[model samples]
Target: MPKHVWITRGLAAIAVGGLLAATACKPGDGTSGAGGELDGVTLTVAAKWTGTEQKNFEEVLDGFEKDTGATVNYEATGEDTGAYLGPKIEAGEPPDIAALPQPGLVREYAEQGALKPLQGEAATALESNYTGYWRDLGSVDGEAYGVLLKAAHKSIIWYRPSAFDAAGVTPPETWDELVDTTSRTLSNAGITPFAMCGASGWTLTDWFENAYLSHAGPENYDKLADHEIPWTDDTVVQTLTTLSEVWGEDDMMKGGQKGAVQTAFPTCVSEVYGQEEAAMVFEGDFVGSSAAEAGATVGEDAVAFPFPAVGDKAPVVVGGDIAVAMTERKGVQELMAYLASPQAQSTWAGLGGYLSANSGVQPDAYADEFTQDLSATIVEAGENVRYDLSDQVPSRFGATEGRGMWSILQDLLRGSTDPEGAAKALEKAASEA
Candidate 1:
């Protein structure tokens, strides 16, 4: 799962005040020029990554700075996230550049005029460089407010290759087969077939959306995001119902109902590596990195498949980060260009194995066979690669609907709510939103 960092109120106030000051001043602004450009300068960039993730970017940024003679003052947001930066941002002390994990943050800053909109050369360069989903997610009301830095693959179905081979089982082709296979495997091995943890509110919601992507197909999913389809639609109900049955049942999941509510999604990944208690985990491709960080091998020990479809549809999920610029610093623009460059994409994939939005870089070079196969699924998926529904919708609606999902899912698992009741609650939440 991706981590979302938030800005502190003090930072937000500072950011707002700075923007107001910048807006009020003339071409040659208060303390800087209107464009805020300066040659041979350094610009700060804050993000959630530290250690390996930070090194992955810094190594790439080093080349950019060396080539352009621009200095990059990189700040690791660390585990604490953007909470530390919000106050500085609100008070107009934001870094010249920052990468927000969620698109809603981009929308909020862009709508409030806290971000610098990319136009002309930069916008055209971006449009010509990334996928349509990347372009769309970074824009607010049709203007580009951010750039797609990199993407994480979210539609992978990971299984223990050796376990599946020993069980004489093959990946399922459809949703029904998937459910059936899950049950059969569990019954035969006397182990839970699926490893799912719903402790974190959004992690549980991912299961709903991933299942929806396979069942409803990408076109219909997009319709939901656009508010063209009602949440009360049969597809929505069916998807939630299917999820409840699988998640609510005992032995069907690695941990029982009690375990589901307590296990962090990342921790439950352990059930898949040589643990008969849990056999498969549906997660993003980058999950393998977490697995490795937890001392699991990538290619030999684990493998992946696309989340099986309900019928014949392919699956895709939102895979990119929205990075916004706060100032018009010359070095910052140069750094942004390099960050979105093909070289950076290659380095990111090589280091972290996440997909890149850069058109010039391909995943096959460094990605393992499973990663390669996953990329093929993504390409074959094409426009079916629906943007993450939660990120596409207004933030408030996402929060409300997400909480409703958590509450309803917990109730269904505990037998406090029936499928119909859960569906009705979700429908109500969606409708009210």
Candidate 2:
């Protein structure tokens, strides 16, 4: 996922009334003390958030502290959490709880016996607040080890509404229509149709994953993610060929293949907003914030539609954080339970820059109508949502640096590798990994 910039204006303040009505108890509803009821309980929580993100999170943590009378020490663990926490776990001094960003990493830690299973109130809270899809994402084998804290809808196309109106084009409903629409936008409107963020290899992988999920369906997607089906399988070949229809075209992309392969993710959104070099960019909802940062008005100048269907139905690919526990202390369990509740999720949602999969949370909890609509779309998808396939796989085969999908797909974007060749290379990489 790209680095996110939150829109803080017009956010609703924390609604203690709503929180009280939604949950069984406020942290220290009846208890009274200097530290409240949970006095002297200090939890060490870690995550990959820093700066603005960390500050925003602390606001929510502060609410928890006031309600429960417990203190939380938050540590910004950076992106490579495995490396950061491995030594701590080895030394038997892991944080009480950690907000892991990757479901794959959570599963890895669970299998290594480095995590505690959610039980009693925490388990019940998760089961009540989240959907089956979200709960399943946090589970490894048959037990729940983590709980999802935030979610991103990845199957979306962010476009300039004015550009679409100028081109006299409505968002396409099918893959064939999308191709035709792109051609018409280029020819009639005289604007580049799509901004391909090839410089950021993850964006390219997202393109392939969405197409593959729509065409091959969810079962095949799962098989591919688990490597039960090799990347050289026909499904992968078909997906790459489908992607190449647009990606291979010389004029369909902003700067052609060369320019696209050099354009970074932020630049891709800016091209659609600031430069007006392209009409649309395919990415997650996070692009809306990026567009806003570049001086484009979200929900007006920039808007999005669900990615057009490639087969029978459009698939929603999701990226999110999964909160996992490192210890089994009672306070740690309480904190995990709180984080899984609608109250905790709603507080963060009201602060902007956050989206929760907690079904119990009201749509209006979001900062703006646009974000509320995005939340509704995710709810509409329901069980149809799929975790990002690349992120679900091992990093060696899925991540950017070195010989992963990033390098392989960049070659495809440069027209240096055909669909078949790319499939073969992907299979080889997976096998080696």
Candidate 3:
């Protein structure tokens, strides 16, 4: 059986907390420590994957190594990384290449001269193949530093088809309607309308950013990128207000407020598809697989839809993927070139469940309808594609100061802080950072 998943609020907090811990370390240029001769032969790669993830990466790297006659060394720490690769890098033993989920962190390293600029064919491939928002994730100050490898769809709401059918509940089309539906589910059906795992700082942060995008418009996130906007903006206040009301309702979320605090991450996912009575969950597309891995029949039993529109704006999604680069070995350049190629992208999608970043590169292996539809949604997103705000924000500010926004929400839920007070608290954090 698959691992019992806990998508708890605590896990989310720990994940972000791990990244935040990396902020205080002294920087390194990934130079080989101990004055060892720099070999242009082996590429020590550190990725955020282990077990099946490690196996999949090894397959791709093995192909690259075999085709190019290069030595490839791979290590995966998975999600248990505390300070990530920061201390190892600081000790002068940094992996020649590392694939990280946070592009904002990658950009910080690049700014400190830790990352080499990816140019020529690699840059061109990224520009032409990936969506513009994805390209922006790995970019800092107008220069492209990282390659786009995977695209995770975030604007998804996973629900049980059986439950909706039985309860005669329809997926709402607008934010107001969604809120109204939540109330209906509680008052009429006695089911928890929304399942919020707020104890996890990161997951709660998702609510903050998602609601922020709709209430404030996606461009406000871009403004935060440039330090043009404060965390205390009125838009943020509105989002917190909305979440506070919805999440505050008794029996609004399964397990109640206390359960929201204690439940794990995977549990939040399970609340949606674990049973027909659990109802819907607002999370990323990956939640679908989590439900399936937890024993729910995917596609038929569970279905996903975009977060309903909050106002006049179209639905906006948040997500990006990990990008990998091996050492600068002979023909490693060629392999890197190929890694960014459409063929590589197609193959990678076949090996893993993530959406391919290479434009027009659809895989032959059949994926779930939701996955396929999500892929099409990425392609058809036009110019409205926005990445996860917390992922894109600088670690010092984003990881540290920005993540505290979750606690502010909790305070709002408990009626300890009003919208205006919460906004000011966020502004103080942002300004201090």
Q: Name the top TM-score candidate.
A: 2
Kindly give the number of clashing pairs for every candidate: 20, 0, 8
* lDDT (10s digit) by residue, model 3, range 1-433: 1221221213233333222221111212111121223234577777777676567767777665554556678877566332767777577566766777777667667766666556555665566556676666777787766766667777767776666666667766667777776447644765666666565556666766766777777677679655698766667767777877666665667766666656557777777765544677777766866888767876666666567767565455656555544244444344455555555555556775667545545423325434555665555565666777777655554555225555665666555677788888867766766
Cα deviation of 172 in candidate 1 (Å)?
1.4
Ordering by TM-score? 2, 1, 3
lDDT of 1 at 333: 54
**Model 3 regions more than 4 Å off:** 1-41, 78-82, 182-187, 275-277, 324-332, 363-366, 400-403
lDDT of candidate 1 at residue 299, scale 0 to 100: 67
Arranged by lDDT with the best first, the candidates are 2, 1, 3
Q: What is the lDDT of residue 219 in candidate 3?
A: 77
On the 0 to 100 scale, the lDDT of residue 62 in model 2 is 81
Could you give me the TM-score of model 3 versus the true structure?
A: 0.83
Q: Which stretch of 10 consecutive residues in model 1 shows the poorest summed lDDT?
A: 1-10
Best by lDDT: 2
Clash list (residue pairs), candidate 3: 6-265, 6-266, 7-264, 7-265, 7-266, 8-264, 8-265, 9-200
